[model samples]
Target: MKNDNVILGIDLGTSAVKCVAMSTSGGIVATTEAAFPLTRDLPGQAEQNPADWLTALELAVTRLGRDVTMNAVAIGLTGQLPTLVCLEGAKPLPSAITWMDSRADAWASSFLDDSKRQMMYDRTGMPIDGRYLAPMFRYHRETFDNGVGTILSAKDFLHFALTGELATDPSTAAGYGLYDLDGANWSQELCAVWGISSSLLPTVRPSASASGLREAVAARLGLPSGLPVTVGCADSVASAYAMAGLDSGTVCITSGSSTIIMDSLPKPLRDSQRRYLLTPHIADGVFGREMDLLSTGTSYRWLNDLLGWENGRIDIAAARSQAGANGLLFSPYLAGGEQGALWNPNLRGVLHGLTVQHSSDDIARAYLEGVQFEIRRCVDILAEDSKIERVVLAGHAASHSATMQMLADILGRPVAAYHHRSPAAIGAALLAAPSAAHSKQMPTDKAVAVPSQLRADYEKIYRRYCAMFPAIAEAAD
Candidate 1:
């Protein structure tokens, strides 16, 4: 590993494109980001033009400085999963349907009955829903007068833009709700059920498999021509790999707009309750039992806007408020549904026990605590199968030490959070590196210990939260 050698990692996130240039020796050379807009004009709609991702990627790469871009040894790709992008030849449709969109919910709800859903879950390890690519495509076909040419996820589109390859890694392909975990290939029956053709789907490849970059695309980004680009796994998988490798004992929670709680397993492990998603992991032969919180940082950001406070002020106010938010319990399901811990798609947000004594600070604190309580529930579920030796936090929510401490107190264990930039991108960079050099990419992390004083109070609140969730959720529904 030389200091000059670098790997370029790009993450086409929900909100923006985050790019990181890291040396094979584990040092971050440079980082840059380019923001893009998410359109939500209609009900249950969330979309972005596919062109925006490529534009953002080029802009982000240009900001990485010419020297760092030129010295890159390889490029790695990772991003949000299940974002459906339709490509007609080399051009994409007007907009790409993001994972956050739920316009297909009605179709999804009515399409599969209990027996069919159970069969799909047993075979695919994914609790199929409207947010998945197959459902979105079905909805698109029925409503719009467009012909289906090819289907690709967000990162796969980026990979095609850069390397002229129409392929997806297993981790991302699993999000389509058609990949068979046992067969390790696309399920033709499931595809027919969704009315999606197998030929329209992208080819599945290993996450770290490489393709040569297109000369024209490389020239536009000011990088070396014909550089190898590795189509990495989902952002959640990359985040998990960045902090804790493919080991089984560690749980990695990426708390961003949405929170992903996952633990890798040597083989496929399905939940009897079907509460968690079983997906392919960073590489072959490994799988992840995963749970996702639909809204975490999104709730925090919503509160910031509602309260007219700055971005980081919510953490300060949350820290000041006493434990339990003075009995004001908040259900952080502002996303109209939840994924893990409770797989109820009709569930809505609830702010229970609000009275005159509750102030904005209390509301903020309650919501912050609410998110961690949800994480605690998912953690407990993961702990059923794995020992959970350590918990690692990544993404934007890990920046606030006070909130991290609150999480630690709620979970009753120390959590190591990477306070640096995007761990997913760094993880992708490590994947892009030579296989033998992957060990060098584990960066330093900050450990937050549980505070004894708050632990007791959170314990009581957590119990009450667990007891009150069903009633509140039912009422809210």
Candidate 2:
């Protein structure tokens, strides 16, 4: 690989599309982002037009400048998962149902009995949830009384728009809730359970598989025609590839709108409690064991808006309060349900022990602590099977030293903050780079350590949070 050549990684996120250019020498040449609005008017609904993703991609690449845009190199793609995109021919039907949507929660709760749910978890390694693509598709058809068409994941839809290919990678396939984890293919039995035809889904391909860029899109984006484009994995998978690269036991938490706690496993490991999700990793012979917290970053943003405080103010306010938030406890389940270490969809956010003495700063601190408590729950589960040798934090929210320190204090372990704004985008770029260049070391911020004096307080707080959770969940039930 020539040092001058650069690979382009386009990451379609929950709210925007981010593009990054990386040289063969493993340095980021340039980066740009374009935001897109998420539709949330309807209750228990979250959606976006697939067309918006393409527009954002074009806007992002155009912002990359002509020189970087025209750079002679391959392209790779990554994006959020389980976002159902229905298409007729090559055009999207209407809106793509995102992972956060919970319209099928009621149906999933009623239709999937305990026996059936266990069977699903055994087959697909996914807890039977309404947020998955299969259930979401079922809900879409029944509610709208619409006829069926082709089905695709969010990234697959983007890939088709970019290269005119109708295919999906394995990591994305797992999001369908019909993919057989053991067989590494779509499970007919599981599909039968949902009354879905496998033919509707795109053909599964390898994450690093390559396809030629469509000449029309190339001309539109000012890039070379027929450029090699790599079909990438899910955003979480891509970030894991960049940060750890098949190195088992190194857990990486990519915190964005949600926080995904994941690590590589040489073989699939199932949790008897079905707390974590097991899926295909970025490459063959590797599996991704992950648990997602659906409301970590979302809670922060919601609190900021509610308080009319700017972005970083919450973190600074959190720093003003001590470890336990002055006896206040917050449950960061603002996303209507919880995922990491808990699969209860009935759960909602709770503010416990609030008092007149409590200030906005205390609330902010408690919310941050609540998120860390959830992460600790996940980390504890991950450690149950394998020792967590290292904890690396990545994503938009990973750069905050104070927040990262709080996490370290909660987990009683050093947490290394990845020194990148978008690890998923960089990981996608790495997928396009040559195998030799994959060895480039990912830069990380200094590890945050738990203060010695506060260890006892942190431990006590974690215990109290754990004790309070079952009662809270029981009430929701």
**In model 1, where is the ten-residue run with the lowest total lDDT?**
441-450
Candidate 1 TM-score to native: 0.97
Residue runs of model 1 more than 4 Å from their true location after superposition: 1-3, 444-446, 475-477
Compute each candidate's TM-score over C-alphas. 0.97, 0.97
Q: Which ten residues in a row have the lowest lDDT in candidate 2?
A: 140-149
How does model 2 fare in lDDT? Answer: 0.87
Please, what are the lDDT tens digits per residue for candidate 2 over residues 202-261? 888898988999999999998899998988999999888888878987999988999999
> Which segments of model 2 are wrong by more than 4 Å?
1-3, 143-147
